[model samples]
Target: MIYNKRLILAHFWLAFALFGVAILLGEWQMFIRSPLHGWLRNADLYYRSVTAHGTVMGYVFPTLVAMGFGYFISEAALGQPLVGRRWAWAGYYMIIVGSVAAVVPVAMGLDSVLYTFYPPMIGNAFYYIGVVLVVVGSWVWVALMGINLYVWKRAHPGAPVPLAMFANVAGAYLWGWTAVGAALELLFQILPVALGFATTINAGLSRVLFSWTLHAIVYFWLMPAYIAFYTIVPRAIGGRLYSDSMARISFALFLVFAMPIGIHHLFADPEVGAGFKVVHSIFTAMVAVPTLLTVFTICASVEIAARLRGGKGLFGWVKALPWANPQMLALALSFVMLGFGGAGGLINMSYQLDSTIHNTQWVTGHFHLIFGGAIVIMYFALAYDLWPHLTGRALLNLRLVHWQLWLWFIGMIVLTFPWHYAGLLGMPRRMAFYDYTAPGMFAEGVSVVMSTIGGAMLVVSAALFLTVLIRNHSAARVDPEPFTFSRAVHEPVSLPWALNGLGLWLGLMIALTITNYGYPIVQLIMTPEGRVPPVFVGGKP
Candidate 1:
């Protein structure tokens, strides 16, 4: 029943608004990659678009969603108002300013390093400063989540944190750790070169540092979606959560294992040794642990709902459940994409298999399916579920909402499936053009062009989604009951501190990251690596 209408609406609106823009940019980039008139055939514009597209998608949109959704969880799950209202507003404005500052430089072709740190190829100073501001703003939100949780615990000393809130804080801390590597690189190395304080940077070290942030950041984006899975989806399906304790363990496991596994991203890079890469690959596989746990728990919860509704016999429950409900449909679709994406990811975790697809379209397809298809479907569902509560407007028309979801799901599969095929056919990524007439490239040429149709489908889906949200304002209003999360079959009343509080997990996560990253980072710094001079983007010839 706790609702902070303006506060919640502000955060959600900004996040999705930027998401809309990023989607348009993404489709254009897709077209550019296609043989469809070569998408204007300008490399400068293409790289600019890539940087803008990646930055917003990777940093601005996801971070804001997490932050906004974190605020919503704080108030709703805790049965209290948020403690740091002014600070939250301050953080939002910082992100807004930073997003503009960061993206403007990208659009001007002055910061075309393309999202990840490629430090020996420095971009504009404003670009790095802008990103730093966004990170700092997110850090403020992280502090607020901690403060809110502590305040709640003080009032109810022995209680288990609500599952949603627990997951929220878990993600906050996870991101807090994840941002450090990027922050260090920008502060010490990239910024120095950009501002003319230093002329050379160790490119290997930049890649290593960015690798630390790279993979874990995906889990951070996935956090809100996963939160929707455990906390909201079961309730939407009219089922109680099967096991609250299991949910807690999954989130905790992600916190412990997600950060260390970033090394697996460096598997093809020479900066890290074979032993460390092997260790990281082993640890990276641990991600599947929590993922499997989640799959089991959610599927069980859905089965319970089906049986309660008088679903009879094996698999009949699937029919009894409400596929018409957007939340239900989104969960089913999200899981479908997750299956394909996760399987593709398993290839990357293997050192030899990873080498086969490194910097190829296959990796791009895997990323898009996982994040765009699986993760983003739930973001849509979460937004639909919360909009009514925030605006006191009834949810959008079921038909339109369902159609939007279906289009995105189908379009994503159509788009990414081809990328995987083209990649296997020796197609490289980040190119603005491809010669379709080249011998033996017929299949690859066909793949990229066909994917453009998928891109167009996604763009249409995005438009429909925005329409659904905007149309809700003029639609009839209802007196909404304050929203609620699902019940656990046995409510988590008193739980172990390790499951409820982040204190133990935080310490353990730090130790794991240090063990994984410490030696390579220090070696790259202390020893002489071949340092390269800055090639500033859009600089003088």
Candidate 2:
């Protein structure tokens, strides 16, 4: 832990810094589009900010945090120093360099294609190259995670790997495979057009390849948060994890179900057939099983903690749990938001229901509720828990931390509820401005007003969160003990190969991905008519 302290700190700080900038960009973008702020509107600038904000928030922040958190887990859970400390640093450099390269073009308005990089709306080649570099850097971390675990297992035979390390490695393995989709899209399709090597691109093929990475990447973002739920939160709240076996099963299920379900994202696209979409949709629903398992497992774990504290009655267990503890509060709130978000997800996953909300403001709202609300709240909890340990200083103010979490929760509800309503009212997403005077816009206009209010609250919440972290980082030392993780109710004595190892699961993920995506990708490549000439609109700055 001591050996890799600087490495972990560097990655985390970079992630939050990007997060801060992105939040401000988000608020600004929303404000400019609102009726209250017409003077701020600039189509070019708005899209540029959108591109930067999405890329930083979606790609940069999550990837860095996951990598840093994985490194810390490897050392702490495995009880060993990181094996490839130097290679880890090299990976960090690649990410840093890649981020700058990518952001430069976006900042200059040369790559306002948004994070999706949907073609034939090609951005500069530098943008694609920069993104590729970031992926390559993460792959290095993935390799390190695999090597570290293999070495540890060889050293200690017939022992169940520490649960936290086991989950972390699972996330790494998931990302390594998941990223191939977009990486291929960039290398073969987008880059060629951006570089003038090709006159046309198969837009359908590009979308298909991206669909490969689109949804699974959410799981990659989510794994660390789930790790916190299973390992950190229970212990922080004074309870043991409900079942070790259930946790392992959840991770395994996520690996198997999450990879092949990306085709669900393409239900609106014509190139993919109905049979494939239905198959993908089934797998998409299957992905929810792990989440359900986690919800049940974590709640049971929390109840145990509450009962341990002498709470009585059916729901009194919830009240008996610690509310003041930021980590505990974060867990409760995250689950609540996840419930709402997950329900929305079920609506989107359904073929018939999705047509109602597809490409509307509701889709954006659903995502924010899940990613920003459910997932990011846990990230805050993680930071709060880790800050003291990493800095060797107690947090400067606990009250501020508590307030920040509540504000984030409240703000998210306010922001997303209106978004969902407006989406249902037939408001389109990604629009720079809406004509409030247009026919049938009364409902949309009202929802926009509500959304603006919520956006304002979120901006305030983001400011408070950053302030707390900055103040806490500079505080004087108080605690001397290192941070600890939760233990399981029944710790494993021995585990099966499937739960304890990756060999079997990784193979399954590959076969499933091929079965799901191989034919569509091949057909796109082989058929000349599927290709369309690339049209580059956002020119180099």
Candidate 3:
């Protein structure tokens, strides 16, 4: 039994560590602001901590969990062992090394740039090395994913791709393409300059290139969420996918539009041209089509399940649906949270509207709601659902799990909703301390009091979550096998050959990119002599 146990335990441990660090950082940044208030805050330390948090949560946990899921899917769908077990282990160690190396400098207060360390401002050289280690480690996973996809396609020939493998491959390809921009910035621009191999680097160019990666990374982070939406949510609701082909089409759409729209991040940056920003802004809005499709499809699948189970009326199905079920609850809340957050995103992506809200706490409010509130809630739900079975034990406390989710959702609303108001009222993000000493200068007292209250709520909610996780680990009479879930209905899907293909989607991505960015990017690289140097605007002006 021990020999055959999945590596899910290891994945849980890593996710817990990373999540713990993130919550603690949230606490520190929210409550104790002075440590970072001064400009003298160590760059090396700041960068290290930021990198550690980002890599562990953003890179490590997701990759490990995806690998765990991949292992299961590969066995079930393909009926074989992973092609290279040793390489997988090596990749794991590489991730560990990278995570450790990356965080040490930050905790020590030696690295201080935020997670995205653009050129000219350098962190400890070790920080760059650590990031590279992580990138390379994940690259191996991509290679493995590619090989797996290749083998499956070769074996099956014209047979339809399994929904599970197809989803995974879509994410894998999206990741590969997204990483290209960040990797180039890291390897060719940031690292060389940081290491002193180059005397000067174009900060504008660095940001422009990094812009190519920034937003798509969110998709990488959300892939696991999407995977669960497709693979687990339907089954939990006693239904199969609404349409297998639609799922593929949504993923294909995500891959096609996700990377190119990163320039929406540069909408306010001066270096990137307005035309490019406008083009990306359009794509940014367009990308929502695929996300909305997923939402509609998943919701319809749940509705079908409820109807089949004797639910009645358009809304009666909601009552029949298992709101107490973890995955259902997670998906439900995720849908609600995305609506609020997506509205905020729409404002940010607006070419003209962004100028009014740029760099304000509204941006923070939006991301925290989406990433921290929505995505993290789902992670907890998924882990809770998987851990007990993986550990061969009854859940330590199901009640606590439900309670924690409720508190987290409540806490997130209490914490972030006000930030939206404060941002519209002109609150800034990343400020270590507020300069609200003068009465009537701002809603100084009210804002601070409300934020503090929000902070406390968040802390309490996080404490509940930690308790739930710990209880699961220490539960008595742990079951050795998970409660297996099965779909109530299965649907067969076949697509027209065009819909079955990825070639069309790939072409769309290329065509859109060339039409939108061709001139700006080309001029940036080739006509450097004609360009005026960017003005530095941040001093005592």
Writing each residue's lDDT as its tens digit, candidate 3 over 1-541 gives 2222355466556666667767666655555442224343443343344445555656666666666555545544555556666676677678789877877765655456566774566666666678778777777766776687678768766766666666676676677767777787788766776665665566777777787777887877677678778877887767767777778788888878887888888778877877788889998998889889988888888988788778899697778887777788878888788889888888898999998888888887788788877777777776776666566656766677677778778778877887777788777766655656545535633554565566567677677877776776667765454333333244445556545555577677667656665666666666454333322111101
| Candidate 3 clash figure, as a count | 19
lDDT of each: 0.89, 0.89, 0.69
- Which consecutive 10 residues in model 1 have the weakest lDDT in total? 33-42
Candidate 1 deviant stretches above 4 angstroms: 39-41
Angstrom error at residue 56, model 1: 0.5
TM-score of each: 0.98, 0.98, 0.88
Error of 1 at 474 (Å): 2.1
Worst 10 residues of 2 by lDDT: 33-42
Model 2, TM vs. native: 0.98
Q: Per-residue CA lDDT of candidate 2, range 85-112, in tens? A: 9999999999999999999988888888
